[model samples]
Target: MSGNIASLRKEFFQLKKDLLSSILSVGISLILFPFLLGMENSLKGPIFSYIEAFIMYAIFSLPYLILIGVPVHIVSRVATKNMKTYKWVTSFFLHVIPALLIGYFLFKNTLFFLGSTVVISVIFFSVGYLLNSIGASKRQKLIIALLPFILWLLILIPTILTETTNKALMNEPNPEVEVLVNETSFKPRPSFCWNSDGSAGCFEDKEPFLLPIDPIGEEIQTNGDVTVKVLLHNTERSYTIEAYYFDEENSIQKVTGDPHSFTLPQHIQEQAVKVIATMDSSKKGSFFIPIRTGNR
Candidate 1:
């Protein structure tokens, strides 16, 4: 009876050890997955803040590790399992295939994801093997496994600096497609555009002039008379607008119209004009609109 009890206790301890090791491997792999993989383009967006990105990354990786990654990790850890025979078979079916498909939707490069998973798997399982096989104190084992993460952090610092330096170097804008519209303090550059009536916005050369900030309404461009109505709606929401027409000598004439119902005077006809405006609404933004005369 004493002998049987000893055997049972020893078996229970071994099982517990294996379970804890497996859990640690899974947890560490999921956490490291995103960081090791360079996924800036896929993760980046105006809508995604840092907290949201971290939460999303965790949510995305959790289920996958639970379903496939954990299983393979445990099976590979089993003493009876020959890693040489199972490496490709398990990795291809359980890790690579699913990861590639998921990456197709989540990332720009599918192969990149596969490579990341491969690296993660190698690091993860390799650490687990070291932890289990090596006879050392628990503290010593933790330090051993943590070496890889420490190395990764060291590499990450220089990569970030390089990316920042590259972005700073690319300070110039596309001169062929975009032009600056600044002139002076009292008088600025004039603009001319049309209503989005079938042709969308009226063009200067070919492509329609686009406002950097979006409009309150669906249509960006409005005509001489139509813009007056737009100003009325925008002003009610605490928007300030300045409308003026420019003569051939670049002298600008301010179009002082009522915020409720503005109308362009007949005298200010047959020339290009613009309105610079800013709004303080739910979607607080600013833009410039140009109205072409004699056309629309």
Candidate 2:
């Protein structure tokens, strides 16, 4: 009876580990893959839209299952097998989920980029922990513990080096071009219809006042440029437009308004504009528009 009970417990523990592994893997894969797709921008055509939708589903849903749900289940199993309290395990996840959500809303696009790295690091540590805890012998346990440390070293050294290099490059200054919009008229209408190109035909709503801007296209060119007009259509609101340019080395310089006329500097033909609109003493709506000088 004693031998049978020990065998049963071992079987149960193994089964629990397998189950947790599967859940964590699938949950992580779903969440991480969508964010990866967005960062890569690899998908094209009609399929791109579908993939984007799927990515949204994965990002919002998978963390609950992987970090909170699977971890809870694993902690219970680990507790039973090792007589260790699972309180910390549960608390860690409870804290992580809220932090992750806060980061998601605040960072948006950037959160996914950073989150992917964090999730991969976690998976690496989890694998090491699992191997070490469940090893069959002392030699196996030693290998498992050392392997993770080695793998982490290999991964982290290059990452740190690259970040340092990027930071050094980022500190370098670049040339700038500026464009200024002279018009300061504010429209009384709170809502206006507009085409996607910010043309006179399209309209915008009150609070999130969508400024119409031209979409970028394939086959980048140097002379293909379009003019966009922005109208602040609220009595209480006023807008200021500023355009800037960067040189070949990506150093920024202002090129417009100081001398009048929207000029794309030769060194900074690919420029971007920021339209800042203030209303009732508070800055309200702001948008960015990109311009490239080229004909395609």
Candidate 3:
């Protein structure tokens, strides 16, 4: 009876260890996923912003990780335990397929969703396997646990430096140019939607919502060509400028560069001119500047 009790306690401790390992693996993979996605877009932000976003995404995805990721991870670990020769093959089926199915429900693009799941599953399995490897030292396990964060910093630091350098070069004074408005803001929107048919869909808006321009006066008076700069943060896409007065289209200008400038019409008194930054046909952002004719 004592022997059976000792064996049961041993089994219980081993189970606890496995569960903790699975949670760590899944949590690391979840945290790394957004950074991986950001890499496709050149990780276009500061390191701190990326960290902040990671924290926010982790917070929001915690429940999903607990509900789906932990169970799947444990199941894969258990299913592949006895299959030493075919462990990887078994792990792939057990880990990747279920994750792919979940991704299919959550994402619309077949290739993108499949690719993301495969990457995540690979990370999850690799981390778990490294942690549970026979004869692995505690130091080795610690390294495995921290590998994701190390990899993230390795990639993130250089990207940020390059971006900073480019911005510095762009900021160098040119005698022929003048920057009227330079502002930045954080505005993020949902990238996915759900259809009535229980399928994932792309979230596209016919007209994107307007983001307020701070420190730039909404009312202004200009006697000649009034140059105004506009920028949309955290996007690599180009935006076109459209000017409207009295609810009629005045002029449309396609802007292909960041920190672009546009000239507002002169001699317009107390009438608001709407300047829109249209990124794509599906989305746009705008701000209003009330034009006054008289001088200060």
Candidate 4:
């Protein structure tokens, strides 16, 4: 009877771990995938639309599930299995891999990277503790549950305050180009909408915004010659570059799938490379980049 009870308890523990792992996997996958939430609004057409959207989401979200969710679930299982043999190892893998991937790909900001580390660490720690803290007192369990949230507040509150202060100190939007910073976390890319008012047709409520996301005029490559290879994203590419590129010899070419070449006037110390973009041939605005001519 005692042996049977032990076997039953082991089965229940394994079940709990699997259930929790699955729930966490799905939740984090959704967060990582980002576009998963926009499906409801995107699929309002016919019954066919609903089925299509469901198929699309499953296809799109599968990679995130494998990349982020599976790794996290594996590490969590390791930690829960013994919590002694490889506790720190499990936590390190859980925290570092995802944080590094997110920070490196998304933004190279050090603060953001550190914040990711702290937030994920606290989460894993709290969850691990709570799972094993069944023998602890109520107060201990409560503290374990609330500690991660408190730590996150401490990190984010300062960032919020600093951003607000900086914006207040220097409040100026470029009168020409219309830029939109998406409040939606799902698709975390800034977009330039056709409209400057930040209202209709800007937030991509209609169709996916397909414009080059990177800021313009950041020409890269050499000192002798400047070459800007447009990393053409299916999601974005700067049409503005195609319009206003000219050389000292009056030679020009549109920015295409390859790195388009342009020449600055010889002997001129500096000149502004004028860039203009038009949507539906409406007069949008022109942007200028001042390039200096020198080996220095």
Candidate 5:
């Protein structure tokens, strides 16, 4: 009886360790995959931007990882522990099933979804294999798991310091503009419109009423005269749009327009604009539009 109890306790501990390792694998995959994607596309942004992207991915991914990944990992590890033939292959396929499912639902594009599934499955198998090879040494496994986060911090610290020093030297305050409008007057789409006869009525509110300024291209060139126009659909409520950019001396400058258009400075290398749409003195939403100049 004592032996059986001891065996059960050992199994429980092993399962606990496997669960922890599975979580670490999910974290590492989320952290590293965005960086990999950014590199593949030659994307440039601040360290915190990448971190924010990772956080958004994690929000959508954690549910699937906890619901599907943990159970699958624990079951497959236990099932294949004593198998003599094709154990790793079976484990790889098991992981691939969940990865493919996740990729399909997460991505809408067919080609991109297929490519992402392949990459994600390979990452899953490789991480799983590495963790298995580390045996039951918790300390060693943890260090390997946390290596990506440590590397990210190393990059982030220097970026924060450099930005702080430059801001201090430039003595420039971040440019911003605030305008207030009545929120009660703003008409969002009704939950269900009813006619005089108490019948449901159809309202033509298909598109978004308020939208931020859309740049002509992915990257805007700063060489010649540049003008950005704010597009707002609802003419019923009034909206104020302002454009902000950094000057040659790295000081933020604000440019206000006549309700629709704003002219930007021509000498800046890059323009980072924050478009804030507020109603009733309450902030509704804001978007960051990063425009980079020059040929890559």
Candidate 6:
């Protein structure tokens, strides 16, 4: 009786160690999966904006032990517990297939509703059913084996229906237009022409314009716009042109430019900066002549 008790204690410790190891392995794998994969385009919007993307990425990106990784881990965890070879194999496979399917759904953007809660529950049920139904008749084992899948389907069907119904009603919006300002010249020249006379007088009676400080930095502002103008060489027609201010966060802040004049906030005035906006690929060579308060 003493010998049997000691052996049972040893087996119990081994099983406990294995379980812990398997769980840890799965966790680490899931954590590393996203960083390893390039999935920027997989999410509907910015990855940061989408909750589904966050959860789905987590579900799929995990290490091998977490999903398919867990099954083999289970075998290792229970190896010393007198677990039969058939039972070990069955246990590993039953948990593994569902995990793989779940991971696949994440990768394929199909896991719209099957959340982490459902996934964890399925894994628990599979492990319990596999262990409990072992040594039972083949028919009983088969039924037990099917339980997780059936539960997954049941959980998934309603989730999918709700997601579909919700989307149909209040559909997600298109991605925010990523407006990029690709100005041909960062420090653009004034549109005014110089007078031929040596009096340094302006010709063509043009409004005075000011050169903007680099929106990116606090480089000292240039007082006067340059007179030298580059020739237009692009074949494309009209491009949507706008001015933007690069805030401290490095995001574009659009600036309103009206006929030779730019009205900026007090902060922008103090910084002496403006952004020249460019439309998408369609617009090629757009230019703006901005004005300073004194230059008018």
RMSD of each: 14.8, 18.0, 13.2, 16.0, 20.3, 17.5
Give TM per candidate: 0.39, 0.26, 0.43, 0.37, 0.41, 0.27
Best-to-worst order by TM-score is: 3, 5, 1, 4, 6, 2
Instruction: Show where candidate 4 strays beyond 4 Å.
Output: 1-5, 8-12, 28-62, 83-98, 101-125, 171-296
Q: What is the lDDT of every predicted structure here? A: 0.47, 0.44, 0.56, 0.46, 0.53, 0.42
lDDT of 1 by residue, 220-240 (tens): 222334335333221334544
- TM-score for candidate 5: 0.41
Which ranges in model 2 have alpha carbons more than 4 Å from their true place?
1-13, 16-20, 35-43, 46-77, 80-109, 112-236, 239-296
User: Among all windows of ten consecutive residues in candidate 2, which has the lowest summed lDDT?
Assistant: 203-212
C-alpha positional error of residue 235 in candidate 4 after TM-score superposition, expressed in Å = 42
Which has the higher lDDT value, candidate number 4 or candidate number 5?
Answer: 5
**Distance (Å) between predicted and true CA of 39, model 5?**
8.0
> Candidates sorted by lDDT, descending order?
3, 5, 1, 4, 2, 6
Clashing pairs in 1: 193-290, 196-200
Q: Pick the candidate with the highest lDDT.
A: 3
| Candidate 3 or 1, higher lDDT | 3
User: What local lDDT does model 6 show for residue 80?
Assistant: 28
lDDT of 2 by residue, 1-296 (tens): 99999999988878766575656545555644544434334456446755675677577756754665455445544554544555434433443454456546646777443454334434433442553354247675566445424544554565567667556434423212222222322222122122222333433222211112454432122342333345443242333434344545555544333212344434234544443332322323444444445411
Candidate 6, which segments miss by more than 4 Å at Cα? 1-115, 131-133, 166-296
Per-residue CA lDDT of model 5 for 1-296, tens digit only, reads 99999999988877766866787767766776666344322245557677776777678667766777667776777778777778777876786677667777767465444444445454555566666753447775565455445544554565567557545533422223222111111221112222322222323222212112555444333455566655444323355655556666656667765674676666554545554443222223344444555412
Better of 5 and 6 by TM-score: 5
TM-score of 6: 0.27
User: What is residue 224's positional error in candidate 1, in angstroms?
Assistant: 39
TM-score of 2: 0.26
